[model samples]
Target: MSDSGPVLPWLVIRQDDNGNRYRVGRYATEDEAQKIADSLHARGRHEQLYVVERISQPAL
Candidate 1:
């Protein structure tokens, strides 16, 4: 974050009943993420959706 390359990406996901996090997708804005979650919910996937800031750097 201190290096100032680009702001970290936001992750939109939900934890399943089995304690597994469903990696929905990354978005530039929370609203975009929520739209995806809402669409999924309309189809009957009931789980809490949230946005998480993640490091943009690739994992080594």
Candidate 2:
């Protein structure tokens, strides 16, 4: 058998201040996920933004 496909990590985002959490999106590369996290962090402004960030892992 061949190797499994690339790992697509789940990228979830949440707003800390208002207790609002949700699944923003998923990425096949950590760099992609980080971009979004960075964007969200910048958009958070004064409020705290939370992220359930996970590493690039293969699907089980």
Candidate 3:
């Protein structure tokens, strides 16, 4: 037998580091994640940020 689950929405944030790419954070929604990114930008951590829509794999 096999187990499967539904897919859910996720917000992925990515940042650039001198041409190198890295993930900053992941959240349940874009709004929530953007808010965090805005805060980070205010603190001067990241100069460029983006929000991406994604779906995680099945839980089991």
**By lDDT, who's the top model here?**
2
After superposition, the stretches of candidate 3 with alpha carbons farther than 4 Å from their true spots are: 1-9, 12-14, 45-60
**What lDDT tens digits, residue by residue, belong to model 2 across residues 1-60?**
237565566575766677777777777666778788888777777676747577554566
Where is model 2 more than 4 Å wrong at Cα?
Answer: 1-7, 50-52, 55-60
Candidate 3, residues 1-60, lDDT tens digits: the string is: 234343236655556666555567667666777787677667765556554656565565
Order the candidates by TM-score, highest first — what do you get? 2, 1, 3
Q: What's the lDDT for residue 59 in model 3?
A: 64
**TM-score attained by model 1:** 0.55
CA lDDT of each prediction against the hidden true structure: 0.64, 0.69, 0.61
TM-score of every candidate relative to the true structure: 0.55, 0.56, 0.51
Sorted by lDDT, highest first, which candidate order results? Answer: 2, 1, 3
By summed lDDT, the worst window of 10 consecutive residues in model 1 runs over 46-55
How many clashes show up in model 3?
0
| Worst lDDT 10-window in candidate 3 | 1-10
What would the per-residue lDDT of candidate 1 be over residues 2-57, giving only the tens digit for each residue?
A: 57564437677776667787787777676666777677766755555443545365
Residue 1 lDDT, candidate 1, scale 0-100: 40
Cα-based lDDT at residue 59, candidate 2: 64
